[model samples]
Target: MATPVLPRSVQRLIDEFARLPGIGPKSASRLTFYLLRATDNQALDLSVALQELKERTRLCSVCFNITEDDPCPICEDEARDAHLVCVVEEPLDVLAIERSRAYGGRYHVLHGAISPVEGIGPEDLRVTELVQRVAQGQFTEIILATNPTLEGESTALYLQRRLAEYGVRMTRLARGLPVGGDLEYTDEITLGRALEGRQEV
Candidate 1:
């Protein structure tokens, strides 16, 4: 049977939703139909929220994290350790670290990792800004909090080389098994890292 033709507006919304990362055509169609069936102002609210997200949010000048303010709250907070900076792959990573509540220092969002396969490189990121920050001689250490993926590793290595001359202490986030994970189920990389980073009990 031929697929029934959808209205242009409905199809357009579905197509837009489908363009979002991790959203398949079927999921987009479901979302569009769900919005159509809704009696409340959810669709309008979503539209307004999206508009505000684009219009109101901007990158923090210092850290490159998404924020309504220029420096972002973390960068502006004087109580935080100004000399310690944790460099991460994206704005979401900053949020993840914040949720941990273990890090009391500020952050620097790289926007993305160095993925040559995806055509992303240091030039495409805020590397220049980070280098400039390092050259300013304010930070005493830089924690490389990039993920353990190949791209993340490459980005971290490149950053290390670039900032080595600045003489600021550079450290990587320790990789290991999870708190409750089984040793048998753990991957070799994580297990090895755990062994390498083992601390005296």
Candidate 2:
């Protein structure tokens, strides 16, 4: 049988949804149809929320994490240990670390790991900004909290070499995190232990 045609607008939304990570064509179609059936106010509410998400948020100038301000709230908070910086791969990783409540330091979000296969390299991320931050002589410790993947390890080693000249305390998150695991999925207990047991690089 020939494929049935969907409304142009509906099909457009479905295509957009299908492009998102982990969302397949079937799930995208389901979401599009669900939105089609939703009350006008409900659908409009979601539309407005999505618009505002892009309109109101930008990367933090300091850490490069998504934020509504130049510096994110975490960067501005005086209570956090400014001398200690936990370097993570993304904003999601920052949330993961915060959930553990075991770290009271500032964060530097690299936004992504160095994946040569994916065409992502040090220049593609916020590495230069991190080097500049360390050169400022404000932070005393640099914690390499990037995920435990091969790419993550590669990125961490690259950072270690790049930042070695600053004469700062550099440490890596301990071995409790699985070798192939992403930090975003690690449980609080395990993540907390890893934070506590971090060792010098």
Candidate 3:
């Protein structure tokens, strides 16, 4: 059945919302209607926030993470371990690592992983910039913190080969079972990695 006649402005908003990833037509319609019924300040706040998000954020010139400044605070901080760099797939991955507070090093955001199926490759990412940074900087180690997936592995391997000539030590994030997960429910790969990475207790 056709959708009931909606005003052009309302339909436009619904269409825009539907264009966003994971937002279906029904969800888009609901969101548009919700904003329509919301207070003027609320809707205006959302619009302004979106506008500022685009206008104020840019990829950091050093690490390629989203930031309002060129080098970003992490790259600028004197307290951070400048000799260590954690390389990840996206800006969100940087955020995830930061929340853990277990690492006090810098970061390099690739924006994406190698995925031939998606037509994304080394050139499509920030690999060249990373290589240049390594060559010019005094980093002692590059931590491959990419996701534990096929594409992530491929990207890490490619990076390892490219940075091999620099002789900088490279390390991968250890994979294992989660603390709350049971061994019986764990996949074979996770179990194997956990065993391989086991520490003396």
lDDT of each: 0.94, 0.93, 0.96
Better of 1 and 3 by TM-score: 1
- In order of appearance, the predictions have TM-scores of 0.96, 0.86, 0.95
lDDT of 2 by residue, 81-135 (tens): 9899999999999999999899999999999999999999999999999999999
Kindly state the number of residue pairs that clash in model 2: 0
Residue by residue across 59-142, what tens digits does model 1's lDDT show?
A: 999999999998899999999999999999899998899999999998898999999999998999999999998899999999
List, residue by residue over 134-191, the lDDT tens digit for candidate 3: 9985899999999999999999999999999999999999999898899899999999
Candidate 2: residue 134 Cα off by (Å): 0.3
lDDT of 1: 0.94
Weakest ten-residue segment in model 1 by summed lDDT: 38-47
In model 1, the runs with Cα more than 4 Å from the true position are 1-4
Sort the predicted structures by TM-score, highest score first: 1, 3, 2
Model 3: how far is 135 from its true place, Å?
A: 0.8
Residue pairs in candidate 1 whose N, alpha carbon or C atoms collide under 3 angstroms: none
For candidate 2, the 10 contiguous residues with the lowest summed lDDT are 2-11
Looking at model 3, residue 138 earns an lDDT score of 89
- Backbone clash count, each prediction separately: 0, 0, 0
Model 3: ten consecutive residues of lowest lDDT? 2-11
